[model samples]
Target: MSRVLVTGAASGLGEALAAAFEARGDEVLRTDVSYEGGVETGASAPSSTHGTFRLDITSDDDWAAALAHVEATWGGLDVLVNNAGVAGGGRLDVATMDEWQWITEINLFGAVRGTRTFVPMLKRQRSGRIVNTASLAGLVHPAGMASYNASKAAVVALTETTGHELAAYGVTAHVVCPSYFRTNLTSSMRGADTELAGVVSHLVESSPISAADIAAAVLEGLDRGDELIVPDQPARDAHGLKQSDRATYDLVMRAQAAKLEGAPRG
Candidate 1:
């Protein structure tokens, strides 16, 4: 079985992914920020996970420890899933610098840190995969998701560049962009806009799909060797538009935003 490490594995999307990997018989290391309450685990967390460790994704020292642990236990890692993220609602005009930094530190830099940590091992193996979780907002740019959108968009770019750079080493990198799905990120989001929070929460809760579904899509994407994995249908459509049509895509999104109650008008 391949050795796999999944960040943010205590709950929600990360937990779902960890469970899926475990079920597939891979040796899984589930990592997350150790909360005062406990390590977050989803209802479907698998009993077969190899181990769980405390990992603050934004900290370089924590990532070093995680890699060291992997080296001690498994000798090498076959898959690294950079799935940890935090959402922050933003009204750009009024958003503070600290708000941007908070979101960027975890959402974008967290993935970059994970990728950088694992690349050496992956390159040595000459056969491994890296999956970075992004979002549909990265592609479509929803009105109120300024910080989140920017971070995820950066993840997309980072993953793509890694994929290209690692091609010669036979190590593949992928970015997963999923649309609205139930995730703990909603509860953990930081922002002052209650209305933005309410809207985001509504969209998340209203999603017919669960984190498990997104995990399944991710596995499928891995099997297919897709570099850019758009897990949900909405994300797939949005990504398709970005890939196929630029002008019409932005125009449509802007039109939709025009109807938003609090959105800025043209």
Candidate 2:
């Protein structure tokens, strides 16, 4: 039985991950920013768990307090799932700086802060795992998701560096880059174009993959010790394209604008 801490566990993929771990007899510390209304964060299943704690990923104080709680309650963590993320989409030229900062702070820097806080504990234990939730947009740059893409790509890089730095200490780090899946991320996204947001929302809503599917894939990755995990076939394909052929990938992504009406003609 492992001690795990999963961020953004109120709902969606995070919730599913927490459930999955609990099912496997792991003690999970489930935390999320939205603890009050939209979704209940504290629900437990068949196994033991720490009731949801209010964790705003953007706050350093929150990270400190969370670590304190983990140290006090569970002593040390075996796995840290930095799964909290917010999506943003709009043309690079028109997207607001606030949107960029918001996405970066929540999606990219959140993982960084979590890693910085927990690496010491993991190193002390001499065995741990960090799973960062990135997106296919990070590996495969999309035309309208520059802010989101850049943030996730940085996470990918961070995870890679972490894998190298922590391997000797018996701590493993991995990045989960998934494509469109049904989740609340679409509803909460911040961006300039409502229509474009809707388009992405539609894609997620219509997608066959569910949050549960992603959670399962993530668990599989952890078990397999994958350094970089692409959760679905679409994400795998996208990552492969980017790795094998950059020019074709860019052209294909840029050509996506042709399908979206009113997207700035480039």
Candidate maximizing TM-score: 2
Clashes of each: 1, 0
Error of 2 at 144 (Å): 0.8
Clashes of 2: 0
Per-residue alpha-carbon lDDT of candidate 1 for residues 145-221, written as tens digits (9 for 90 to 100)? 78889999999999989989999999999989899998777988777656677778898999998999999999999
- Residues 173-230 of candidate 2: C-alpha lDDT, one tens digit per residue: 9899889999988767867767678778889999999999999998898889888889
Ten-residue region with minimum lDDT total, candidate 2: 37-46
Q: Record all residue pairs in model 1 with backbone atoms less than 3 Å apart, i.e. clashing.
A: 10-40
Runs with alpha carbons beyond 4 Å of true place in candidate 1: 35-46, 244-247, 261-266
Predictions in order: lDDT:
0.84, 0.85
- Residue 17 shift from truth in candidate 2, angstroms: 0.6
- List candidate 2 stretches off by more than 4 Å: 36-48, 245-247, 259-261, 264-266
